[model samples]
Target chain A: MAAPAILITAFVVIGGMATALAQSLGLFPLVGPPSLTVAAYAAQASDLPVGIGLSLAIAAASTVVACLVGFTAALVIVQGRWCGKLVAALGTLTVPVPHIVGAASVSLLLADSGLLARLFNAGGSWPELVGGPWWIGVVAEYGWKESAFVALVVTGTLATRAVSYDETAALLGAGRLSRLRHVLLPLSLPTLTVSATIIFVYSLGSYEVAWLLGRAYPEPLPVMALRLFNAATLTARPEAAAVAIVTTLLSFGAVAAALAYLRRSTLWR
Target chain B: MIPAVRVEGLSKSFPGTGAPVLDDVNLTVEARSCTALLGPSGAGKSTLLRAISGLERPDAGRVLVGGQDMAGVGPEHRGMAMVQQRPLLFPHLNVLDNVAFAGTVRGVAKRAARADAAGFLELVQLAGFGPRPVAALSGGQAQRVAIARALAARPAVLLLDEPFSALDPELRSVMHDLLAQLRRSVNPTVLMVTHDRSEAAAVAEKIALFSGGRMLQHDSVERMYSRPVSLEASRLMGGANEIPGTVRNGCHHSALGALRLPGDTTWPPGPGILLVRQESIEVGPGNGPGLHATVSGLRVLGPRRLVSVDAAGVLLRAEIPWGRALAAGDTVTLSIPTSALAVVDDPDTAHTFPGAEKRPQITVQGLATLASIDN
Candidate 1:
């Protein structure tokens, strides 16, 4: 690679690590006195388990749902005529939006006073269009967004994969569903994992969605940290910094572990 | 038993393509017979093979597995297996899962699928490779695994789209032997598409030549090569020496000299082109019972030699044995035997086909298999 590209990449990596370290050290002057201390760590440690649990539920559920839907969409597009074109046309529209934008859009569309409700009201419908607590939105958003992302990813990844296997599997007496379940799904899994993990990590650190559409109480990790930083006392800033560090570290850990597991699993070999 | 397959008027126009790649292609592949689709690069051989496997939808036509029309049958419903030119094994699956893929998808228990898949692995001569990663396989081994995977489903029809084109000649020959074994033992009907006439001739019981969006001819391998119905079929089958001749008194007089066609007595004297296979011309000395010619150059094809000679005024290529080496200036007698000539109305050639009078001193060697003769 050219020096500029390498330098740019290195700078991004260093910049991310530096910011993570600064946050962990409570260096921000706006909310608290800047210092490296173990007090923040101690205070946040009490809340870590719940936060981690919430993160896992959201991330894992989203990854699995996204992969199933995405891999299936990829198989259909690659194996089907009209459906493939339609999938291609609807690709990647929702994934790359800035976190704040994504969070706001989902909130506007699914919140009680949102467009969905307005549409329901216009129809004189009684049942709320999108209801329930954070769990519902967590599952619903991840399911909706990640599937499309996975679909796009799988399509690109499997472009070189042969259409002939469909034929061969058929010639071998495989029925339509069986061929997909047997030949197509298994074949697309490696790429499925890669794409799922990418969206998983995206979900892991995602703050905007949780802030906009997530429940106000029993706050998500990002929201919890945000509330701590906003406290009047300077003492709470270190604790908030500590929570941010832990959340960032958890995201890194999940991605790194998935990468390692993928390497050892013969998926890439 | 029902014939292995029957196809009629198969035609496909790719989305956005103005011309149909495959048009009105009719065929019957009998049970356990090996049939080859032969044509040049753009002759729609691949499209035809894909259509049979139900991988590609034809704009018009019918594909019958037995007596049933399979117009809307998807590939997975066709009970057929296909091998593409490049081996496209699932990178995510190990050899065991890759070969057993279809069976498992059909709800075969994993253990049973793996076991039956192992049997096919043995059939393709890769018995112990069940655990190997796809990337770890050699080119030849990967191709064999693809075959194993396809055959494991036990589909009655097997389609190969230039599958062996990437293999070295030696490996291709090995594949041929393996296919012959399948014909005898497994007894699957085979339909293969190839640009290589030599490979088609070697393995196929029947050959169908396609050109200009139509099947020029489909017949036994020998008949297709020796008695190609048109100039296109002849050209695709390695008849590079062509000459425009005038039919006079039921005898065609050409730049390659004169010859008689039994079927030409009814045609009025006008213009026609004579196609001569390279092997038809025997090169010797003197104008004794042949077209007068001179040695131009020669190419040595492994066991045989192709002697380039000038017959009359036209440059033509003829295959000769490697036993003797002729220099560039030697006077050579070129024979234009009646059986060696195919005449057609000169179509689209206006340079008076120097092919008749313009002799380029060139010889082709190494490609000297006569398997295409005597259908």
Candidate 2:
């Protein structure tokens, strides 16, 4: 039963990638005889470096912020009183909202003349948060949306075995801080790492949030690829495929590193 | 010196329960003593242990360690350590680090704490096993490490909750001996909870019997066996036969026949329960001049034979040497010495022999009358 699904998925993904690779190597030209060349990679060499750096910075920042907030939310949901239920409900509510809708909502909320700035009557001095040089609005959109995902996954991990382990630590003479440091943190590390990897790869490849909230000078890799893929000139298509291939490789590398780290964790066994 | 631990008037009830799980319970353990809380499942033995260890807060009473009330104190601040049924070792840490955890939490240097932990491992006979991962240890070895971890804290009191229930019988015996040796060398006041009476008797100096959320009796192991205070306590302490009888003029009359009571007996003329240990009864040929009984069943248990006999219409169980060629359908004579009988007022009519048709109906008034006979 699973074999058919696996085969279909693998075929679609690998077929799509093979087509992109052929176009990226100048072997599947739209208007001329196909010839293998590295011109597509050379054409975007200057801007590709900038796009990669900007993408890494944004994904890394968003993932770090999301993980910190999400982990705290998970702890609260697992160990807290009445307020924990409220936080858990809010996280569940946030998870199903599409990223495109999230980006539009963030754009409306954080733009210079948006609701908050208008409410405070500080439109002239709203700090340029939306479409700013630092891409704060883009990072905030990803962080807000992905934090909920992290929280739900982590809550599931902790709900299984954390209470008994925490009680054992308490009986073993571990105080609140000691229990958190020795038991909860170490036990949650593998799940946290896995969730963080998902968040990093998701933010790296996502297009709508960055395009909706980011400045034009240093576009993220996904936005840059989309722009090149839609250009009027036909030669830019191969460059777009080249950028997509690089982004896929980076995401794969991150997932591999995370899996290796998870294997080495004592909690994995 | 002050007692190592004291629990006074402890009572706790869950939200939906009608009666309290722990009801006005009190217990004490002297310095350098080992006490076992013995009871059946759901008898609140473990709840009492947790309440004393500061893991559960009592509604009406307080726990005292070294005469210091532990109200509002956390388990860590109460200077007590507990070993649970599962070893509960922190899986992220090696055996040495897990054993050294309490010391490190108390702010001892890691190196010194590890050295102390090594000594504890040696005490548990796992000397070179310090660096092994906790997952690699067998069930018995993991529990041994748990004991070492509890001891490494040098706690004022130690609590164990059925710590050996998961091990095999042979490993359980080995753990019992290890605990006994550790008690001699370290001398920490210990309270262990177990449903197995033999396990409690083997490891503890004193045993506290509990049933239905109430402590029935607390006494030395010898006294708990030879002189249980109540019929319920007598049954819990392994009394196999209960004979209902009436006391009259310094003699006790029962289905087993009239027997002279001890001269010091204070039991007034009243209905009471006579408890007989299974081993105290001897079986012989039915032709002898004694209580004539027909063998109902015989079970060979290692070096002994458990023989069940029916005397007249009363069923009695006896344990005899395996050399006796006894089988079902054989006629036998049973002998019971009066000195081996422990008589007390029948607490309730819940348990009684089948042939005793004239047994008195238990009433509140009758219980009160029997209670007065003791004074």
Q: Which one wins on lDDT?
A: 2
Q: How high is the lDDT of residue A142 in model 2?
A: 90
Q: Candidate 1 i-RMS (Å)?
A: 2.8
Which residue runs of candidate 1 sit more than 4 Å off their true CA positions?
A: A1-38, A41-48, A62-90, A122-132, A138-148, A162-168, B240-276, B285-293, B296-302, B308-316, B334-375
lDDT by residue (A185-253, candidate 1, tens digit) is 766767776787788777777766666666666666877788887898757766677777777788888
Alpha carbon lDDT of each predicted model? 0.74, 0.86
Among these predicted structures, which one has the highest TM-score? Answer: 2
What lDDT does candidate 1 reach at residue B157?
Answer: 82
- True-structure lDDT of candidate 1: 0.74
